[model samples]
Every structure is written in structure tokens, then in C-alpha cells.
Target chain A: MEQGIQIVSILIAGVIFYGGVGWLLDRWLGTMFWTPCGIIVGTALGVYWVVKKYGQAR
Target chain B: MGGFLIPLEGEWVSPGVHSFDSRPLFPGVLPDWVNGHLAQAVIGAALVIGFWLWVSRRQQIVPTKRQFVGEWLYDFVRNNISREALGPDYRKYHPYLLALFSFILVNNLFGEFFVFMFPTFSKIGYAYGLAVASWVLYNAAGIKRDGFGHYMKKMTLPEGVPIYMAWLIIPLEFLSNFIVRPFTLALRLFANLFAGHLVILVFVLGGTYLLTLKDNLFYNFSGGVSILFSFAIFALEIFIGALQAYIFTVLTAQYVHSSISEEH
Candidate 1:
């Protein structure tokens, strides 16, 4: 249960962190596309982090 | 059945988030700071402190009933939660773990009680406050145990990662550790209590509303059923309240353990 909550937090954190970056970039460049791209990338990275930290043999 | 036919004065409005809002217990006499949940929190704190004090006032070679209960609570948190989660260093943090468990459990049980039907944590601020405290404690412990720079590096840069992937991994690690931990911790507790209270409201109020629908025998029958189900839900709320308290305390211990441990 604790691990499950932590994993979820990581996923949300990833989206918020990278998505915020993407939004900032979009604002600077005046492009509408960067936000979605950032979210996708952020999610991918978040999943990767989860796998890296938790997926391996103990 | 005919006696139950009297109609309710107002429409049965299903409870929503607004249900959590507090009307001042004292309309104008009490200061603005004193509201239902705030008062409940204060009461909960007092109850926890008083109970512990009463239990610990006299040392016994054998044990009284009160002492037994107190010892059971202490041992439960110390052995089951802190020891199991924090390992050899658990004793260092036992007091904190015990306090947190008792405080939360009392406040949560408030929701099921008659006079104070609000779980203090259903208010998001209280949950966030506890989370922030835990966050600071764990991070500080980590930094204190390992040097600040070393801790930061260890937290952000995992072992066995490729050098080329450092850029990608660093930000993710930073966000996961620094940002997500507290956010999820608060949200999990807040959401559970908020939803649990809301569910109870729906069942009880809906059932009461149904009981007043005297025009239909079916409605009256189902209303009785709904009220009965609400009792079962009340029982569930109590169990969840205790479980959430345990879960929160255990996770806090785990975070502390991870922070101070040599291995991640």
C-alpha cells in the first residue's frame, strides 16, 4: 500500500514537473504543441523512474 | 406505515464537498479561528494527550487494564510500525511514530462519533501540514546523516544508471523525491477521509429522505434498507479511519528509514 501510493506520487510528480517545463517553454517560444509533448515525455520518464527504482530484484 | 407518511420539509439534497464546510459552533461569541473541524482537532489532540497521561501517570510492575491498553498501543506502534519499517534505528524515532499514530487515530475516530462527526484530516490543510512535517523531518534526517551534498547526489542520481542517461534521470528523481512524496501523502489521507465522510452523508441523508417518501411502500422499505446499510458504512468508516492512521504512520517511518539508510 505504501509503495503503491509512492509510485502514484512519482507519476503525478513527473507530469507536473515536466509539464510545467513544457508550458514554460511553450510560453517563451509561443508554440502550442510543446505542452502535450512535455506531458508525454514526462509520463514516460516517470514510468522509467518507477521501473528503475522498484522493478529490479531485491 | 401511515405514521411515516409525513413529508420532509425540504428536498433531499445529496451531500457534496460543501458538506465538509463548518458553521461556527458559536455563531459570534467564539473567535473566527474556532470552527467545527478546528475545534475537533483541538479536542482530538487533548483527548490523545490526556489518554496517554492517564495511562502513564503511575508505573506498575505488573499491569492494570488502562496500563495494558496503553502498553498495547505503545508496543503496537513501536514494534509493528516503527520497528518493522525503520529496523534497528527504530527506537530513535519511536516517540514520534507513536504520537503521530495516536493523534491521527483519535482525530479519525472523531468522524464516527456523535458530537464531532468530522475527521480533522478531511480538511486538506491539516493533512498537508502533517505531510510537510514528515517531509522536513525525513529530508533533514537524510541530510544530517549523510552530508547535504552527498544526500542530494544520492537521492537524485541512482546507482547503476548509464552516464548518458544522467540528464534524463536527474530531474525525474528530483521531482519524485522532493515534490511527489509530500503531495501524495497529503492527498491520500485527505481524499480518503473526505470521500468517506461524503459517502456516509449520502447514505444517511438519502436514507432519511427516502423514509419520508410515505406515498410509496417500496420507498419506505428501501429507506429502512438504506439506513441499515448506513450503519454498516459507519462501521467501515471506523475501520478505514484506524487503517489510514496506521498506514500514514508506517509510511512516515519507511520514508525516514529510506532517508537515513546507506542503501536506497
Candidate 2:
């Protein structure tokens, strides 16, 4: 139950972090592609994080 | 806006977000932030402190009822939450864990049965304050256990990762660990309490309004049923309050464990 909340938090953090970056890059470079790209990459990173950290531990 | 529910004093006043607005106890004298919720939180703190002190006053060998109650509460946190998370180092963090559990539990309970039927944490500000405290506690625990530099490295980096991925991984870890953890913690507690209180208000307010409509048996019967059903909602709120307190404490312990543990 506890880890469930953390996992969801990590996923949201990924979106907020990279999505923010993507949004800034979009504004800077004047393009719309990087925003979605960043979101996908971020979600992948978050999944990797959850797998590496909580999966094998407890 | 579903304004049909309330038609009190010939004015339709729908129960919505305005239901959660904090009215100041003393409108002009004290600041708006120092409202009924703040008073409830203060009272809750006092109640928690007093209960612990009352229970732990004198020594007991076999154990008196009050001592047993205190011990039971202590062991619930110590064994189940702190020890379950932090292993041998659990004792170092048990005191904070105990206090966090009891404080949140008491404040959450304030919503159910009291002169002021409101949970202190329903206000997002109070939830954020508690989250910031938890954030500080976990980070400080990590820094104290390991040096700041080592703790940062462990928190951000995995056990084995290519140097090429540093740019991508570092920001992700930083956001997840530092920013989102506490944000979600506060959001979860605040949202649950706020929504639960709103639901109770919907039933009670709607029921009361409906019952007063002139000579309509259908409206009166439904209103009466809704009012009766609100008791069950109150019972559910009590359970959720206790569960949230448990979840919050356990998650804090988990974060502390993650921070101070050897492996990232």
C-alpha cells in the first residue's frame, strides 16, 4: 500500500520533471515535438526507477 | 452547478468548494489563516501530548491499563512501521514515527465527532506544512547517517548505471525523490479529507434542504433516507482517517529507510 503511493508519485515526478523541461525546450526551440518526446522518455525512466529500486528490495 | 439542492431562506446556496472555506474564529483580530482548523490542530496536538504524558507518567513492571495502552500504541508503530521499514536502525527513528502517527491520527479524527467536525489536514496548507517537515526529517536522517555528498549520490544514482545516462537519470531521481514525494504526500492527505468532508456535507446539506420542501412525501422520504445514510458515511470516514494516518506514517518510514539504507 505504501509503495503503491511512492510508485505513482515517481511516475508523476517523471512527467512533471521532464515535461517541464520539454515545455521549456519547446518554448526555446519553437517546436511542439519535444514535449511528447520528453513525456515518453520520462515515463520510461520512472518505470526503470521503480523496477530497479522497489522491485528487488521488498 | 447542481444548485437545485439547496434553497434555504428563498436563496439557493449550493454546497461546493465554498463548503471547505475557512472562516476565521475572530474575523478581524486574528489572521485568516488562524481559523477553526488551526484551533482544532492545536487542540489535537495538546490531546496527543497529554495522552502520551498521562499514559507514561509512572513506572510499571507487570503493567497498568494506561501503561499497557501506551505500550500497545508504541509497539504498533515501532514493530509494524519503523522496524518493518528501517531494520536495525529503526529505533533511531521510532520516536518521530510515533509522534507523526498519533498527531495525524488525532487531527484526522477531529473531522468525525467533535464540536468542530473538520479534519485539520483538509486544508492543503496544513498538509503541505506536515509534508515539508517529513521531507526535512528524511533528508536530514540521510545526511546524518551518511555524509551529504554520499547521500546525494546514493539517492540520485542507481547501483549500476552507464555514465552516458547521467543527464537523463539525475533529473528524474531528483524530481521523484525530492519534489514529488512530499508533494504527493500532502496532496493525498488533503484531497482525501477534503473530498470526504464534501461528501458528508452533500448528504447532510442536501438532506436537510430536501426535508423542508412543502408537502412532498417523495422528497421528504428520500431526504430522511439520505440523512440516515450519512451515519454510515461518517463510519467510513473514521476508517479512512485511521487508514490515512497509518499510510502516511508507513510511507514516511519507507522514505527514511530509502534515504539511510546502504543500497540506493
Query: Cα lDDT of all candidates, in order?
Result: 0.86, 0.86
- Model 2 clash pairs are none
The TM-score obtained for chain B of candidate 1 when compared with the true chain B: 0.94
- Error in Å for residue B209 of model 2: 0.8
What is the TM-score of each candidate's chain B when compared with the real chain B? 0.94, 0.94
Mind giving the per-residue lDDT tens digits that candidate 2 earns over B149-261? Answer: 98998878766667887777788778888999998889989999999999998998788777767678899889889999999999999999999998889989999988887
Error of 2 at B247 (Å): 0.3
Candidate 2: C-alpha RMSD to true structure equals: 3.6
Tens-digit per-residue lDDT, B140-246, candidate 1: 99999999999999888878778998898788778888887888779889999999999999888888788777588888788889999999999999999999999
* CAPRI accuracy category, model 2: medium
DockQ, every prediction? 0.62, 0.65
Off by over 4 Å in 1: A1-7, B1-8
Model 2 error, position A29 (Å): 3.5
Using all chains and alpha carbons, the TM-scores for the candidates as numbered come to 0.91, 0.92
